[model samples]
Target chain A: MYAKRIITTMFLVTALVITLPKGVFANGHDLESLKNTVEQLKTQLDKVQIQLKAQEEKTAKKKDIRDLKQKIEQSSIRPVEFEINDSIVHLAGYSSVTFADNDGAGDRFNQVQFSPIFHYQYKDLMMLESELEFDIGLDGSTTVALEYLTLDLFLSDYLTVIAGKFLSPVGQFRQNLHPGWINKLPSAPPGFGHDGATPISDVGLQLRGALPPLGNVRTNYSFYVANGPELEAITEDGEVELEGIIAEGFTRDADGTRVYGGRIGVLPIPELEIGISGVVGKTEVTVLDGAAFGDEPSRRYRVWGADFAWKYKGMGLRGEYVRSTIGEVTASVAPAGAHWRSWYLQGAYQFLPTKWEGVVRYTDFDSPHASEDQKQWAAGVNYLFSSNVIAKFAYEFNEGRVGKSSNDDTALLQMSFGF
Target chain B: MKNYIHIKTALHAGVLILAFFLATAGAQAEKHPNEEGDSAQGAKLWAQTCSRCHNMRNPKEFRDELWVAIVTHMRVRAGLTGQDTRNILAFLQQSNSVARKSSFTKSSTTSESKGIAGIGVSSQDVLARGKTVFEETCVACHGDDGKGVVPGVPDFIDGNGVLSQSNEVLFNHIVNGFESPGSTLAMPPKGGNEDLSNKDIKDVIEYLNATFGS
Candidate 1:
């Protein structure tokens, strides 16, 4: 049934490609040609399978192994295969969920989300990928968002350029997915705000390339503009600092803000990867103008972080730290604190060798009083259905301090498909 | 106590030297030799000897250390004992190292080698024999399309000078399994069957050459 579904999907996609606008189709003719080739191969395979099935029935119990061999030869008299280059654009995705129980609170399911993605490539180069997410249940925030749209230009075997909105490449977990439903000892890393701002996506450009000496070194960097928090300058007290400022209405709200960041990573060995990433930019915030809404102010924010990851023989360990500071220069707005820091540590193991991966992560933030400012512990497992899709389930335990001290526990289940 | 101290110091020094040698060997071992290994023989050995358990391992998977381990393991698996295994190991390590080092050099030397069997297998009778050998041994994994089913199975379509490998290199892998860690499966000795002679494997290599390209 699954094979039938896959075949039907391929046929529909092939037909869709044929009817696409010529301009769009022409741009990706290489992809179209590869798709056609795969389709043709599938057709030939189906025919061969049908013949093989018929022969199997004919041979039945009285069939001699030698006679079966001769039957195979007779079947082989016809072309079992056609032209050969094996290439195609694959589409896939995956999702995860978790349930948890804190110290004394009632056990509950925490977060659940789905990330559906599409990937295109041939020969492992000239690739494009995009991820979309829709979250509900457990945490139950019903909305859809674009996760990342990356166009990778592999310049050479070792050099590549990625452009578009993507995970800021900040901390390890910011780019890495959740292991299961549990948070490790220290889950939240620095720079990520109380609302867990680490998975920040922005429209920007990046260049990722490797250094010489092949396996010794590699680096990734990016520059982008994205939606960010507002920053306004406040006096010693909580008053806005707008002494000698000319308010220009030239900035359009839709124009958004500018975000610039870069990440440089290195892999000393094939198993160990480490990197430092930083982002600095301005965000727009609105103020009340004597009971009326004021213009959006450009708030300056900076986030810097470092991460280390070791993956060898199915044992994976990763840790990251980030520090974020926001200073608002807008007049009349109160100045917030200097900086808020967060950090986390995580570890995972593949119990079923390379088939199933289990993860544990822990995160803590300074302001544990806010709804989103609690320490999180989560654990989960991922079952790889194939190289591309996976089924995941996890549990999270969140303890809130300083404020109301409500415990948020969650159970999440998700299925993600990707290319 | 005095003797123990001396032994400990010597052991420390020995450890240090071995560590340095292994590290340096790992770091600097990428200088590849000229294309000298028999890829055809390697393929046959892969089908005959290696395929008994696992699929054919593509040589391009490893850098150096892993390749060394894998090829050495295969030597033992092929029942080459010790000395035979070592010889075969030398051939594989030399060939794989050359492929890697050339890819990274100031200029790539991969294309410099001549196409395999530029002279041999040109005769019709020789081509016919080579074809038969291939049908009997190589046709399964390599497939009729010449695009093998498993990943890492190098397509014969555009492989440069793959068939043109030196007979010695071919014989080494054919007689001994590929020992690279990157190889998921070793090419068994003498294409695993042990029935064919070194010359038989050579004929198939020639057939691969004649069938794929000019």
Candidate 2:
């Protein structure tokens, strides 16, 4: 039994030795494979972490883009809407300051005038225009005056109906050339001022427009009926004599008379214009020595004028003549006739490439009173900063009745601006 | 006398009624169509009419809307025809905007030293187009004889006048604006016609050379 046990054990031992050798070899190989697998897992984990980081960076970039787009949308300017039918208001005007030295009156800053023109328009149908004048009086006080006001209605392509106080159609000087910036000289012509031969203004309705072109000759006409002028009488040397004619636009027709007047301008060429004007009415003496008067007889009143303007390149030439006559009055305190007449010729030449202009004018004024009759020559130099802004220097030589203010020579320096 | 008073009153009433009727009729009539203005004709009329009364105002002095009102006011004051008003307004409106950049391309035959050459276009066609443009645009200030009509307009017929310059210089002057040495006004770009193309300017230059060049 001992011998059999030993053989069995030896056989079992042999089997165990072969199987343990094979198993040991398999275990070592498996451990080497396990280590390789762990290394592969580590490499895979690193790759996953890199991919996740890439995705996170992409998301962050998208967020920045969104924020930038939001910022852009927040800041911008939009357009304003405008319609055609809306009412439009425009302001325009002229202003002037003058320094004057007269033979009798000393030199001073004698005039400061601001004329503001306001326009309110409702399409092309109608427009309301007004000019307000502000002046510094000689007494250092401010005076406001309405230069003119008109409601102009466009009746047709070539016609307009105007209602209100308007610049008189009697002459071109009062209507067109009176603006300080437009007048080449620093002062108005000798008798084209207040209470001059030319009527200043009228309150009435006017029809003014251009006529159809007649060949190459164009024409414009203005017709009006207005409250006429009033007369003044003075007590001098125990006799009543007509003093002056107040032709400024009167709000009331004290004489209950109407004046009919019209002006026709013909332009044979673009550069030349010839105009003729006339007025006929009746006027009564409403004031006696600056006081109100009653029961004065109405007298026949008439005014006539002629004017011409020619422009060539930088040179301009213009002339005007006016006459006013009052018929004799038999039933009034002032029974005598009176008349005023005046004429002026002016020429201007501008030196181009330079803002300089030279002007000369000759004027003759004849009035009822000998002391008021005058003849004058005016010469001026102008510097234009722009087309609308001008500086003028003028000298006037006057000849009249001796020792009268009308005979005083004067020098004027003026700066005028139109906007 | 009483009969005279009655007649006068009737006349006044008649005048008032006539004015009212005219106003109402004008107001009720059809509004003017939004017609395009003729900038070319407008330029000519503006040069001729504005100087008749006052010095020429700069187009840049006011905005577009303000020009409308201002021109309307001038229409009444100057007794301008409706066509005249429209034309002037168009010129002013076109002149007030920012100038456009020139689209002129250098021609193959054109050299820096030489003046300019007709690029693929016949000289005859170029000159014809140029003449039309000049008459329509420049004739107001520059007369048909090429002598200046206005005070400071440069004479193209003079020996040493504007046409004596190189074509390149003339092109630049027209594309941009130019003011004469002694002029009170400056020529607006493209002669105030913003619609003028680079080719139109080129043709005009050629026309000027053939017709008025020294």
Best by DockQ: 2
Model 2 agreement with the true structure over A1-419: per-residue lDDT tens digits: 45654565556556645565455446778767656755675566557666877888777577799998877866532223333545788999999999999999989999999999999987777789999999998899999989899998877766788999998887788988888999889889978988888899989989877776777788888888899889888998999988888988888887787888889998899888899999988888999999999898889999999998887778888999999999998888999989999999999988875889999999999998888999999999999888889999999999999999989999999999999
Identify the CAPRI category of the predicted complex in candidate 1. incorrect
Most TM-score-accurate candidate: 2
TM-score of each: 0.46, 0.84
DockQ-derived CAPRI band for the predicted complex in model 2: acceptable
Off by over 4 Å in 2: A1-85, B13-36, B105-122
Give the alpha carbon lDDT tens digit for every residue of B48-113 in model 2. 777766777878778777887888888877767666777888888888765665334244234332
Overlapping backbone residue pairs in candidate 2 total: 1
lDDT of 1 by residue, A1-419 (tens): 45875776678667766876666645577677867866787777677777877987787554577788888978855343221222334444555554444444556555466766666543223456677777774445577767677776444323344666656566656554332222221223323522343535555545444334343343333333344344323243454432211111122333154455666666565345677888776544353332323564455667788887664333557777776665655342543334555677777765432347677877776531144365777787766554334566667676665344435565555554432
